[model samples]
Target chain A: MDDDRPLFFHVMAYADDADHDVIDMVSGDPDWEPPTALREGLREFADAPVADYQYPPSEGRGDLRDLLADRHDVPVERLVVTNGGGEANHLAMACGLEAHAGNEVILTDPVYPYYADRAELLGADVTYAPVADDGALDPETVRAVASEETALIVACSPNNPTGAVYGESVKRELTDIAEANDALYVSDEVYEAFDFSGRFHSALAFDSENVAVTNSFSKAMATTGLRVGYAILPDHLVDPVRTRHMLTNVAVTAPGQHAALKALRETPDDYYAETRAMLESRIEHFCEALDAAGAEYIQPQGAFYVLARFDGFPGTLDNTKRLIDEAGVAGMPGDAFGSAREEWLRFALVSPRADEAADRLAAYFS
Target chain B: MDDDRPLFFHVMAYADDADHDVIDMVSGDPDWEPPTALREGLREFADAPVADYQYPPSEGRGDLRDLLADRHDVPVERLVVTNGGGEANHLAMACGLEAHAGNEVILTDPVYPYYADRAELLGADVTYAPVADDGALDPETVRAVASEETALIVACSPNNPTGAVYGESVKRELTDIAEANDALYVSDEVYEAFDFSGRFHSALAFDSENVAVTNSFSKAMATTGLRVGYAILPDHLVDPVRTRHMLTNVAVTAPGQHAALKALRETPDDYYAETRAMLESRIEHFCEALDAAGAEYIQPQGAFYVLARFDGFPGTLDNTKRLIDEAGVAGMPGDAFGSAREEWLRFALVSPRADEAADRLAAYFS
Candidate 1:
């Protein structure tokens, strides 16, 4: 907890220190332009009266909540807008921990580091259930690990580091397991829009009342730094989550909310389709280059990342540093995600120059 | 902890429920525009690369940090830009609690409600040191309540609800006591710019290693909705505060930061002077009206709020409700700040319509 470099910061710092010409695939930030609606929305917001710049309702501005409520099909009362997907997830986890008469917060083995870091910060006991070799959840394995003592089970689909979209059956199993164990399912679907598989399933579809779905505009709208996200809570957790949200941040920033509201209302559905298409091409391009180099990798089903295994390397941190220094390419170490995947390296196909980054990796691996 | 209405939300709810003709002064949100520079800055930022909107450094962007460092004359390493002054206080208190070999987090009697809320949420044992009837701190009272069991001493200058600006000696004594008690002094100076008494002193001015100062652009920049604030930490608390900050809200929103950076760089010195002058006039006008109506009030030496005693009412909640329903004026109850001041009703002199609001109060009382 004391200065153990959180993975995101470590990767971003590595990218910053790399050569100016380095093809940075380390950070998850998308490189493409945001929708014109988002940029235009800022200008429109700037022109509004200063009163609009004052504190918004701590829960959120009503219009944005209504928009998201309709989009997610959740009641407006269950939603609490947050600073970003991170806060949304954090709030849900906090709620779970408080209600947790449990000993451990269960997470996937190859976890999003932020979740692990937050669990530690909140003093919740964390335990991991391993993902399949293909980085997909094995429902029984998760069920085997969870119990009345399991505070919450976190599921990330089109997952960070893995990009293995959980299949419908797996989603149903996890939801059922959480419901049976009296634990909450924190389904982080920030990557929902980026699914390569048309069959992206929300845990909410299962109707278990125990699910809290957290999502953000960061990845989908290409505005990660805007710090706006929301959580759809179970009826029981609504008041507590609202209280925690109020005590923690009061509300999300105003202009970001307005821009997000505008983006949701004005942007076309085709924009998401185009983004998916563009990112799929990038993923395929990178994987093909990796395939040509004969590297073992989990082909991403969704999200813009691929986890490639490199056996000859001297662990991930060393490999990542050498890769940045010698190959002029940057990707995250698998160990950064979790200790279980130390031989793997994760690449985010976020940059427009991702192809060049892949080619650099190919040459280095060869 | 079970749904006690936090002050701002409670007041805003009353305002929301009141008739359209209500003269609302319930919340502290300034009813004024942010500087022209801040508005124009958002326009400039909107055109930047999509990556610029993706994520900023978790601690903060260097340019903004550098600007704040120059402004506060603190080392850049000692500062952490937070979501708002609320977060700055939260993070600093977190550090103090972790370091405190103590049982209690010391607060001023009739304290800002958010601090107590945060302390309760963090599981810190909260104890109060009484402020004099004039809403001024008596250092000995704080010292008497504190010992090795004190984890933190929170001092708000241009204090909320009461607006009694602490003098130099009081700040020094508080810092010295915190140092002696092995506790941290979290001095919230968000209202530093609004101090009518030129004698306002910063805890940082004492040069105690135990001191941390939190401030924000919310009140000073008239951009509470923007949610940008910062803390200047003692060298020791820096890393822990950063960790807490990173975990709580990964980073402040980007455009808000850009606008804040612009405001800091481009706003003229006279803006602060003019704001103080305007708020002073409003406060003076309201107090004169209250005096004419034979109402007891504390003359605010700083900040924009005036807490008036309305003894005829049963309690603050009832008084505030009837005031909103009958008199068409809204303000927060003193009980919301703490249990010690239920007879008081806090009016934020933030609206351009402050004079009109005061007239309504006078007419109702008469």
Candidate 2:
């Protein structure tokens, strides 16, 4: 009963070893290097002498605070640095949801899957509110399922697997519900850079008290293994938890923080901009191929993923394996993303050269 | 309530802002650095020209695996490089306790605080049997609580905050009880290198299906900010929990792993010998001061911390604050560790120079 093995790892499993035609499409990992400015900044980092290796403040590096503060419009003290987007999600759910331990953590159905998986590991009871077949999280649906017993309301904008850019009205509704119930809203905005439709208001903007936004350099800056991310935490919830965070994993890697600080300073704008352009074009190309393949999806407005329905084709693990084994186009079944959409499959549009993915999709369908 | 601070960061926090008369007697962070030989080993890392910055195998780097295997006397596949020992411990428990989730995670009283805190966070009920008043986790106590419903037993040797080193006989006893119940034994040996007594034996030496050993370079190598540690897992448990390790914190830092690979090569043995000698003398000196101060504590056998009882002082947070404010010497209250021996305060022996702490302790008591 390895509950984790089959859970979504990445769209591609053996990507580094994949055959030319295997067409690796996996993870939210962007297949690119840090922006030019960020790389040049790395060279400049050597000058700081101390930048050779120094852990950031347990919460985050100061330069990163400035960048994130500007982007999220949150104060510096609210942030706490983590190893990556993964740790950010792990710690946010662990700390932010502390107000209502043992209560249900509400997650949108067709979730990123980690929200439930991590919440389960952290002892929070998980409840799901269904999104429409279009993959958009409806505010009414969220309201209908929300109760005083809910500990956290976790939703991702430019949602993973679905690519639904949650609207500002929906954001306000969720925030209002959380404010009323005193539950936290953990908005994972790792994909904030690629919001092709630009209304990227933070959940923090909606309400700071019940919101702890988590982001990372993994997607936009292409420094995933450098493993730097942070959560904007409310001040009152910061002390006793500080020791646990320290003792749980100790400080994050020193060089990683140093590199992240360099990246933020060197390419704060261009990193997100170039990645945004790349992601937008990839999403468009993938949507075109899906149309030609007669595959159905909401046509992603943001994020580097699309939930294409193989309504006619099989959506079982066997079908997913067949797609990889036969079509040579890899993807995770939408069924794994949600108990309801087993007939659909989610494809990660994470290719530095996504023209390859588009060609592969065309050839497979033909 | 800021339950998100990484464990073992306290040592660095204290070290960073070291005040006059400030003796950081808290976390088991060693006061040392990578040996000159290991520092030179950095050239090998830089020259090899591998992309160390990218994602490593979810298990770990190959050479590092070989080094860990050589050091721990375990097969390479049994090892997983983690962000730190806290992560290794969390992974060991998550993976080992898979079949026994709801059951009580057996931990000794006056615990490391982290063990109970992390286990509780992971949805396990934590039950404690008292260690000795002097802070040794007796084999007898571990045996008395061995139950079918007990998922895993946490044993810390050269114990944090206590400096209790479990003997060979005790480790064998623990292995026997855990084997009988088919429960896993996760021995956190982060303080492995600080053995003041030469009798340190690893639980990894005890042959059992349910035994996992976790240790870090923090104390032994004195690179807390580096945040590199590894877990030795046998064939049966590695696969189930391996994914969680990847999901929990992704990969350990590259430079830290490079540094740890150097730490693992124990050729001249001067650093370990010197660290042990220094720590041993400091423990002796501090205990003597405690004796003069009419305070009570077990003579520390290993590690860099000791739990001392100030009989008339009523070691509360208030007293701890007063000590920090007036005497400028800081130690941890026993209540922070576990419910047992709240009158006792844990003091770190890892000072920049030995006897500095002893001087502070003496002056404070007088």
Please tell me which predicted candidate would have the highest DockQ against the true structure. Answer: 1
Give each model a TM-score: 0.97, 0.82
Task: Estimate the Cα RMSD of every predicted model relative to the unseen true structure.
Answer: 1.8, 4.8
Candidate 1 per-residue lDDT over residues A40-65, each given as its tens digit: 88888889888899878788899999
- The sequence of per-residue lDDT tens digits that candidate 2 reaches over residues A1-366 is 223334444435644344646766645555666655544443443333322333345555567677777766777677777878778777778776675533779898787776777777676788888888777778888788888888888888878877788878788888888777778888888877778777666777764577778888777776555677777766655553454456556567665676666666666576578777877888888888877777778777688888877546866666776777766677777666657677887787766556677767766775
Q: What is candidate 2's CAPRI-style docking category based on DockQ?
A: acceptable
Candidate 2 global lDDT: 0.71
Compute the lDDT of residue A138 as modeled in candidate 2: 82
**Predicted complexes: DockQ each:** 0.79, 0.31
Badly placed stretches (over 4 Å) of model 1 are A2-20, B2-20, B311-315
Q: Write the per-residue lDDT of candidate 2 for residues B1-366, one digit (tens) a residue.
A: 223233234433554465555555555445555555444444343333224445666667789989888867788888898887878887888777775433778888777776876786666878787887666677878778778888899988877767788888888888887888888889889888878777789988876777899987766665566678889987887875566776567677665576567657643677788877877777788888888788888677887877888768866777776676666677776677777878887787665654766676677787
